[model samples]
Target: MERVIVAGGGLAGVRTVEALRAQGYPGRLTLVGAEPHRPYDRPPLSKAVLRGELDDTTVDADWTALDCELLLGHRVTGLTDVLETTAGPLGFDGLVIATGASPIRLPGDGPQHVLRTIDDARALRADLRPGARVAVVGAGWIGAEVATAAAKAGCRVTVVEAADTPLAAAVGAEVGAKTAPWYAEAGVELRHGVKVASVERGGLELAGGGSIEADAVVTGIGVRPETSWLEGSDLTLDDGIAVDERLRTGRPGVFAVGDCAAWWSSTFRRRLRVEHWDTALNAPEVAAANLLGGERVYDPVPYFWSEQFGHMVQYAGHHPVADTMIWRGDPAAGGWAACWLTGDRLAAIVTVDRPRDLVQARRIIAAQKRIDRSALADPAIPVRDA
Candidate 1:
């Protein structure tokens, strides 16, 4: 490919450019970023940045060496053989769609906030003053992290989750309930099984005939792929831009990666749209290789980590609901891990403050190793041996 245009100048987009250059592709690379700022680390938006520990979370990259044309504050409106950007029509021999996803906002008129960008974090941080009433809707990763940061900022935080427990959709209700006490310990109210009907000027109206008074509301329901620009494209678009194991979008010279790509993972035996930093960091290498006529498969043991409420939560691999769950160590004691296995093969692992388990679990899953459930349950037993 003589020329390449990468849409969405986020982590994934930048990584794609870096990978292409690293693979010795001395082509005309163009990166279009909607944000005025360059690609930045997004994970810290809810933690360090929101807490005001850092002025900005801009990503550390050797941009001078990459030698790519960057189109900052440029939005891609549509796509065909050429990208229809606000700047104008830009043609490319190859295209990478890494538009990523946007946070889901709560319905109604209210001062609602989300932790998606540096600006968003700054806006939210300003509202999180000491004793400011902050009602966070949803108990997912973003919600939990925001709540933790707000609490640390001395805000009176109340997390409202629609499920019976926090992270029910992620780790299941049983395991999620184990973390309910964490909110209380942090001096944040955790309200479960509550749905927000609407957001008003000073608070959130509950569907269950109640209301929560808050100075500000933050919603972390989830994110939807930013693929509206590809609405009439010949490529398939489901929840995200559908791509094969090679990250190809059916259209020649077009590929999608990161949060916007729902790649069919042969390893997981299913299509997965992992919206995590690790995916954004690692998937580009494979996609870049494929863009250069290399048959590289993008099947990774999906991994993610979160820091909230004085705990480090890490998960590796995709664990289907049918997998058998085994707990290692006493979860009630704080530091422990839950291993998911399909028959004897390790499927996934979720650990809380157990870095060794996450490190070993990733290796076990990558190797597709069979585990001794009894031995794995013992905290003293090493995962490699188990």
Candidate 2:
């Protein structure tokens, strides 16, 4: 039997090994992870775990009994087809790089936090107090979620973003403009178009010589793909390790998945790296299959969800150049669907507190079918039917 070595035993690594077995690949699979703990779900790390709704005991996975060896807490210092780890030199016929990202940290003084792991969430959650002034450095998904959680815990939240609108880069201007009011309604002081110059002991300095007082600062600025170990490898790295449509890297007998992998997206016809939990979980199925001699393609509709300030935001599909924005209901009304259309077809949809609409919009994107603009704007009409 062939031997397969999996690096970075997060969701993608764990799932890929399980998938290899499920696909009848009778190979010796070894999973190496930097974290000491076993592979756990990360989405909950930001939401339920951070809010004290879940515990560490509940984060354990059910696949430990699989026919594989797990090198937990071991970091792969170098990669050469033969990895040099803290344990020793290990080799394999095939390798899968699934190392995820780390939270961006600011160089500063006291008690600043970034929620990426259980320890991080626990530390931040414990320090959160009612009526404390909480300042968030970024307005991305992580920033919004943390700010929302802080507000719910009775803390005064202030979100600072360099962009003119929050989430302008991810979701377009039209959508970002409408969604901006949620911060003020939730009692959060939203500071837009301001770049953070530096962080001091008491507060953060703004670019234009202003300052924001912060009792506790939480930075969710962004995350870079964890691919530094592959510096000597022959794999191409542009933002991430560039892989083919099958998730195979430039080298033979090697594959990459999750945030560290920049694979070709058939839906958008471009090379992209997705960092969402869903992508991390589902992309491995394709990588494993392809690695096990089954031809499989990693074509997926990008889907992600974020919960904040008593509202659930869900979106699917790629909306790079959405020329028109269509609204099914009023966001101020709490439950509504916002659709982004490129020319005539559905490019993407952001549904606030509406799961069914997001699901239907995903189907529309997958089908590559154009929806009637009027039908999409009407709440009475179902998105699937449109």
Candidate 3:
């Protein structure tokens, strides 16, 4: 490939460029990003940035040393043999898709905000003054995080979730309900099974009748792949650009990585679209290798972490909703984990305040090792030994 173009200027795009260089691809490379700022860390947007603990989370990468063209503030607008951007059309022998995902905004004219960018964090942080009434829609990871930061900032926060409990859709009702008490413990209101009809500035209209007054309303519902520009393109877009184990999008010299990819996972025996930092950080390596005529499959036991309500939550591996979950420690008491096992093989693990369990469980899942159920259940026992 004489000229390679990587779309998107997030962590995945930067890593993809780095991976290509590391694999000794001495050719012309161009990186296009929609944001004016260079690629930066995103996880901090919800935590450190939102808390006003940080202003910039820019990735520590020397764009100069990378010897590639950086087209900041240029968004990919169209695609084909010739890729079209806001700047203009450009030809490429190869392309890497790392556009990532965009937050799904609710229909509203409200003081609604979604934390996805640095600017978004800054905007939301300003409204979270002491004693400010804040209504956060959704009790998922982002919602929980925003509530935590708002409460810590002295804002009276209330979370509105349509589900019965927080994280119900993600980790299932049983495990998600285990975390319900955290909201109340943190002095935040948790309203479950309530749908928001509309978000209007200064108030939120409930599905039925009542309305909740608020100074600010934040939506943390979810995100969708940022592939609208690629519509009708050659790539197969199944929730995201469908790709095989090698990250190939069924198109010659074109590949996808990070959140915008639904890659085949041999380990899970299905396709997975993991929109997490670890996936964006690691998947590019395999994609870069495969791009450079190397035969490699990018299949990893999915992992993600969230810092909410003074708890360090880490999860590893993928298991079906029906998998038997064995509790390693008491959730009500703290420092607990929910381990899922199929037969004797470890399927997945959700850990809270138990770093060692998460650490060991990650390795065990990576190795696809069988576990001793009894030992695994004992919190006193190390996950590795278990």
Task: Count clashing residue pairs in model 3.
Answer: 1
Off by over 4 Å in 1: none
lDDT of each: 0.91, 0.84, 0.92
* lDDT per residue as tens, model 2, 185-207: 89999999998877778878888
Per-residue C-alpha lDDT of model 1 across residues 95-147, encoded as one tens digit per residue:
99999999988888877998788899899989999989999999999999999
lDDT tens readout by residue for model 3, 277-386: 99999999999899889889998989999999999999998868326889998987879999998778898999999988988998988888878999999999899734
Can you tell me which runs of candidate 2 are displaced by over 4 Å? 57-60
Return the clash pairs for model 1, or none: none
Name the candidate that leads on lDDT: 3
Off by over 4 Å in 3: none
